[model samples]
Target: MILCCGEALIDMIPAKTEDAGTGFVPHSGGSVFNTAIALGRLGTRAGMLTGLSRDLFGRQLDDALKASHVDTRTVVYSDRPATLAFVQLEAGHATYTFYDENSANRMLAPEDVGALPEDVLALYFGGISLCNPPAADTYLELAERHAGRCAIMLDPNIRPSFISDIPAYRARIARMLAVADIVKVSDEDLGWLYPGPEALMEKLAALLKAGPSVAIMTRGGSGATAYLRDGREISVAAEPAQVVDTVGAGDTFNAGVLAKASELGLLTPGGLAEAGEAEISDVLAFGAKVAAVTVSRAGANPPWREELAQERPPA
Candidate 1:
């Protein structure tokens, strides 16, 4: 099982009312939540680890997880209100305004977290959970605790606006990258982390030196590229799709990479370190295909395994 540790919240997306005026409608979403749901939909044994409120929105989040086949055993329930993100879309791209002060998911402390199950072979950490305090430190502690026992994949999903203290957040991210086995970053994220005249690949190399065995750089529309610590690199083109909204495109792409890697028995730290070029290329390609499906639709919805053709080799 791949355990996803982070915040789960509601996305208040704008919709046209009967009268034609725009009104917001709630949708179950969060970066980690979307990835967990995508993994479950792709038939991966996925579980969620985060603080959830007992409120209506929280219940909706829980139901959505189970409906997508994500295990909720590791969830921590509370009476606090759930976090919410008010979304604004333009030309199929999304921007969020968060309402998370004192919310259930943001109040998680290190003590609130528990031990991992023996079946969890990998742990994924990212989203706004890494951008806020208390919960940010909480998730990092959990990842650090289980770093070597299982594979650790991180996608900071960097949102500059969410970060209050740039230096402190950079330090935290540095520590996270040090312990992570695989790290994914977008071109914008890379630039933000290492701003200068250095090229994108050069910045990625600096990230590889931080400790992760593999670094994946995603280029919107242009596709993604993966780099190994030993200098091997693989790039894949983005799969064609009728773009609707890029809401959960990156999140679903992450699930696709992990799901395919796990399916190929390459989800372990050592396994990823020794993975071949063909295997890595296949993983990146699968991720692109999965993400293509997500961007071709509305919201953060990911495809079920049955929705795609059988492309994996026999186990």
Candidate 2:
């Protein structure tokens, strides 16, 4: 079992290109939420930890999670309104404008997590959940408590527009990375977080020193690279496809990596830190393939097991 902790919100996206002129549509989204749903859809035993509202949009988000087979038992229901994010496509990449102040997800408390199941193989977290106060603290507490019990994966999903204090944000991200066994960030994120390549490598090495055994840096179409603490690195190119919208692509890729690791029986507490370069390469390749399929289609819809199986040819 894998536990995903963070916000779950409704994405108001462009529906029709002609009617709306901007072509906006609404979809169930949130970085952690998308990862959990993708894991469930891939037939992995996954659960989500976040606050949900009683409103219609929240109901739709809950229904979508259920449809994706995610365990919602750990989700907390609140009277506050659900978080909303407006997603727009710019240069084929999804840019988000979020409105999460006083939202249900932003109101998550430490008590909401309670005691996690011993069977949980890993804990994944990211997004605006780390930006908020009490909730961010709650997640940090949980990560520290379970640091030795299960593998922890963290993705900051850095968006400078939403972050007011860069230093505080960097500190918070650094704190999370200290407890994470695996950290994923985009090349753009690295550039934004640390300006120059030399500075980026220095900072990345500092993060690796914080206990993450593996750090992955994704470079959009250029591909992704993974650095192991043991001094080994490997890179893979992204599969070329007709891009529709890049929304949720990275989140789904994270899911694919975790799913593949789970399939290889490497997501357990002790397995993550010991996973070799070869194993990590396979995981990234699988993730990149899955993400390629997602980007080929419209919206944040990820591929199911059957869909992926059909795409894979027999050896």
Best by TM-score: 1
Candidate 1, overall lDDT? Answer: 0.92
Q: Model 1, residue 57: displacement in angstroms?
A: 0.3
Measured on C-alpha atoms, candidate 2 has an lDDT of: 0.83
TM-score of 2: 0.93
For model 2, how many clashes?
7
TM-score of 1: 0.98
The positional error of residue 86 in candidate 2, measured at the CA in angstroms, is: 0.7
The sequence of per-residue lDDT tens digits that candidate 2 reaches over residues 20-41 is 5666567899999999999898
CA lDDT, every model vs. true structure: 0.92, 0.83
TM-score of each: 0.98, 0.93
Provide the RMSD of all predictions against the true structure, rounded to 1 decimal: 1.1, 2.3
